[model samples]
Target chain A: MPKNTLGEHLRQQGMSRRSFLKFCSLLASGMALSPALVPRIAQALEATRRPSVIWLSFQECTGCTESLTRSHTPTVEGLIFDAISLDYHHTLQAASGHAAEAAREEAMKENFGQYILVVDGSIPLDNPGFSTIAGISNLDMLKETAKGAAAIVAVGTCAAFGGLPKANPNPTGAVPVSDIITDKPIINVSGCPPIPVVITGVLAHILTFGGLPELDDLGRPAAFYGQSIHDRCYRRPFYEKGLFAETFDDEGAKKGWCLYKLGCKGPVTFNACATTKWNEGTSFPIESGHGCIGCSEPDFWDFGGFYEALSRPTGQTGKNAVYGVAAGTAVGAAVWAMNRAKKEEAVRGHEKLTMDELNREGEES
Target chain B: MTSTEFLLWVKGTGFTLAIAVFAAGIVLRLAEIWSLGRKPDLAEAKGNANTAGVRTIFNRFIPDKGIWDRSAFIIIAAWFFHVGLFVVIFFFVPHILLIDSIIGLQWPGLPTPIVDAFAVITMVGLLAMLFHRITQPVKKYLSTFEDYLVWAVTFLPLLTGYLAYHRLLFSPDMLLAMHILSVELLLVLLPFTKLSHSFTFLLARWYNGAISGFRGVQS
Candidate 1:
């Protein structure tokens, strides 16, 4: 545990009280808290000692790490790191070989049952050799590290929901961090590479409250994942108005119509993309004239094709329709033939003495 | 299953089955009607049956003046419900895409707010119609279980759709799945119930007009 409080550490690092308060306000807003809570967050964060964070990378492409490094304004690597003791991250840590492993063990031992464990990749269960850190299998490392963690933050879709590696024919038997460590409170920041502020926001919430944030059914922080992209989308009016871009180069596309026809998954995908946006509030995927691929949702990779609309049938609809029409035609024709035969039979059986028969039938009745 | 998996199932297998049943039932019913050809009239024709039949298809949309006067509320409510249903089904972007996928034709849809307003109107109209059916003594006697069943099925799609669009009561995926499943139910039930009148009413109108035309009377 750090000796000085977060405010003292930031002050020592040349950060003013006003700037720290501003950062707290940003964090409070990012966590979906009301403006009134900003002061409480500031007070809590200023007085609290910085928490120890142990970041572990397993079967990942380091996109999560890259996203974090590029996080908004205050710069996560610069300010957040200054606030927390990121004891071990092989990519960012200077120590290599045994030295890096020693740092992780030291942090775990020193901050036993208090450190925050942030994992950014899935764990491979097929074979220990598939993924190893310093000769330790991912599963073994996760199990060992989770024992001392106060809480765990699964930082990406891979760590949260067994992302691409666990997609269709999951060869490596890849599983998420939650699958292996269910005993601890797990906060899933799920996305192909989750938004930058979301990551910091979650961390800031933990720092301010000294506990995990409220989560959704999927174990994601409800503050960020509460609303879907479609609900907050700017182009939603176009969708409501029945205006869509049939093709990428169409007039609707040029006019920035809804991308539902182009297979936008905003309706089902829960994320802050539409509101928080990406790259310093530049724009999200939908704003770039491309439909959202729903990277944040679980098993997004296996939800048929990316360009296929959410309402479109996943099966061979055309062939099934053809079969339906053929069967219908056959049945229709059969019924038609039967009715025609019955009519012809009646015609053939018609008697010449119809009037006399009718009189006789009437008399009998 | 997860909501997404449920959504996929409804969009895939459920949709296919509903379409097949709807298609077969429609075709079979039409074939049965066509095979029962009308007997040729021995009397000389006073007017063109074709012209009269086509005219009635459009003209029957409005009820006779005396009937309208006696039950103007019912007539107006029924018309609003129908017009609203038509606008929502044909002018909504998502519904249009579904239609285009099946029929290989596309048309520009009305704005979303317009369609949404129309959907609300349709629901209100349907409710008024139902109230009239239940309270009006003659209509209540004439109504059958099938009438209420068809009404429920039609109302479900609209209600579920509105809820899903607004993301109410449930998760977005769950709401969406329910909306789609409701539509599937409507499609499957449409052919077997009095809802088949959507197609059969045209034939009935034509027949009535043709008979009137043969008698040299305006219908």
Candidate 2:
């Protein structure tokens, strides 16, 4: 068996090479690309040596790493480690303390301007006093490390858009990496946990293309964040019929009615959750009967309170939404009232004119 | 017939009727547009009789203005909700399932949560719209008898759907029955009531847009 080959690796794990190829084909097609593109992808991947990757953790819960590295997680652990020569990661490295730090420095020096820098959390801008890696402030460490990187992949919403840390009255004044670094190309892999395939998919694209794939206006890959979740939801029929799940665990929810009324940010949000999905495309938050929090977008936290239905959010986002409903009703009524008044006024004017005309006719007769 | 079979039959009939009315309403609205200028002299533009101001309001629709005034939430949000709602309904999971089973076209289902959230947004937006009908000034003037009934008719099914899902306010089965009945009523009344706006709006929008475009007026 060929060593370090993708097909052979699949076979060693009791998986068929055919199944892996089919999955690649599926993924390719899901991005609205031709299945024919698979062979080229396979060839590029087969020929290229394992690219160096450095996974950096900053002020985060390690959820993004866990999301990417766990076995049971989608785009599983086997796929991630097998795909990249993950030289130095704070969480997955075998080195301890200074050794781990040395390993990262060594990796950067060896793979200068070649390694992919995957940062998974926000960096504190508040005096850089809030966070440090290896005793160096996160800001200093990020700049020092990122200076030689070929591309930076900001994984998770926190790293991409400052996630919850940048929410109202931000305490740490945490900011996304895009705020500081301006030279290198950066891609935002945004989600609360940042879906697994999205992380790996970015790697796969980078490996295959030898650079970043096209990104949207917001720096998210268009292949992943091109469409709104609303455009591909299952319960859309229910919405057209004006059916909705007003509360959690409602009958409409069980029946899979639309959740737009429940403060779902799917409409304003652009993401691939509805299409690519989590859990191997089996289901997503909306499919599981929860409304979207617009987690993938920038400043999602400030849109409105999370967990409150879109209809009833106390904040401006929700207030504006309610205002929309009320305005629709009021304008609809006012149009009718105006129509009715116009009709009545027309009738009165016609009657008075008829009386005057009748008197003239009588005099003439 | 057994209740299940009978219910299916009723649903089938209701769908047929909804489509029928939907089609007829389109035709009538088209006829209305066609006849707008039946008399050349009577159909003059509001500003200049020589100029045909068919562009009046409809041009704001159809291809769309992309974005409009911030204060136009009722119209703008309504457009999103209505456009989004129909796209979801006609092109969503269960609808596809129903269509495939009834008519034999098995398309794919939309992703779950997206459609789910869209429904909730539509309802909230619609309800707020109803409140606006009862509350606001200019909108109140524009409302009609059918508009009020349209609001109630559509809201019942949405509310019942929530009720059936949670078994809140009503038991599951009862809420289910209410939901079905409300949908059936909505369909039956669709063409007759202002609820016809769902279908008519598209034609109305297009006509306004095309005519406005023709007249070289800003929509």
Candidate 3:
């Protein structure tokens, strides 16, 4: 069966080698690798054995998984998923209860220190009863599964940054995968549900490079998180020109002006949404006439309000400007009045200078 | 601090400081000038002072034919520079943004290409004015070290802004900081130097018109 290699598997599925190579190049571009590396990526991917990927779902809505699967049919992302041997995914796998657990344990032992651990959702530590896989709590299962894994990919905001589950007044005591497993090299693919291509890109990088890609300060792949949404946004020119839509459905909005005045967080938020986009490059949030909710950044939920403009000052700025103008006006007005009074007094005291007085003053000088 | 942090300081603490000094200094200087009032004319009355004051504001815009030959270069250059400066100051996107932030009022900006042309014109006009001042006999006699200082302060913001936008000479943060710092210097010096003309030009023109009108003849 020629070892059922990726190249062999694709050939058997009736995919041309050219199509497979094109997919490899696309992945290379997504990872910000030079075009010259395309051939190398193709060669490496085709010859390589499929790595076992164990996807764990804890306190999540399965949105991340759905985003990965439902975006497009027969696409590069789907193909990459097909190429990898997904040994354990509770939702996707037909194996139930004991069988699923057995598969995960068997994969960990068989591919020990080589298998990749992909996690969605945060781990609940407050109580073992909050979430469980079979009879095991999420915390125990994650900790157990993390051992012997080569690396962990935190696949959603919840897994990456304790997202909605860890928002203010959190009840589940949900902590991100990084907090629980500090020993593993964790890459965060963070969004409410991360853009699907971003997930595939991370997987492709690991599979081809045999190591994790370079990451930013937040543990997100730098190729995707390198620029702010504002820097790459189509509406940036409008922002620079100080043209803004005051409200949704206003004339300015209809004219496609900047949404800065209507509380766009594009300026501060960094993600690939502006560049990579969602639903196969159809449109991003700003394109649909809505401001960014800053889904990728940490603690985005607590940034006051989504509709509140970022231009609005938070502290003493307003008071300071008012005091400045008032003090300035008062001083100016007082000085103006004094000057007027002096001018009036001078008028009152004025006398015509005769020729005799001018001659006398000149002679004295 | 990092470049971004430095930028934040300029936008926040630095901006407020400049505004305070600019506002207060302008008031004080204008007050001082206005306090030295002139005596009323006794020989007057063909036209009202108020009418003449308003008339003079517009009248002085067009120079008389007699003195136009000697003062033509100065007047034209100064006019060009002043108009260019006005356009650059109030119409540039960044400048408008700053104004919006401080006052909560905002308006659309001109196209970038137009703003760029105005900036170039302003720079060239300022250079021409400076050249005329240093070379001309009468203007040279009037020029002082303080005048040169004011000129440098005025020229710096525009130059640094150009460099920053084009990403020349330094990093983006450093260039932006330099641009801001130059503007701050200009704001602080405005009342103390000849740049006070920005506020005083109208008042001076009004006074001249009123005094001439009081004499019942157009001077």
**Candidate that scores best on TM-score:** 1
Total clashing pairs in model 3: 0
For A116-171, candidate 2 gives per-residue lDDT tens digits of: 89998899898687888778898898998898898999999999988888776889
- Best candidate (score: lDDT): 1
Q: Specify the poorest-scoring 10-residue window by lDDT in model 3 chain A.
A: A310-319
lDDT of 3 by residue, A102-211 (tens): 99999999989888999999888888899999989999999999998999999988999888888766789988899999999999999888888888889999988889
Model 1 bad stretches (over 4 Å):
A1-26, A29-39, A46-49, A74-77, A88-90, A93-112, A123-148, A166-181, A236-257, A302-311, A337-365, B36-47, B211-219
By descending TM-score, how would the candidates be arranged? 1, 3, 2
Ranking the candidates on lDDT from highest down gives 1, 3, 2
Q: Count the backbone clashes (under 3 Å) in each candidate.
A: 3, 67, 0
Query: What's the residue-level lDDT of A299 in candidate 1?
Result: 77
Task: Using TM-score as the measure, name the better of candidate 1 and candidate 3.
Answer: 1
Better of 2 and 3 by lDDT: 3
lDDT of 3: 0.81
In DockQ terms, which candidate is top?
1
Chain B: TM-scores of all predictions: 0.96, 0.65, 0.89
Q: Distance from true position, residue A51, model 3, in Å?
A: 8.5
Answer with 1 or 2, whichever has the higher DockQ: 1
lDDT of 2: 0.68
- Candidates in order, TM-scores: namely 0.85, 0.53, 0.63
TM-score of 3: 0.63
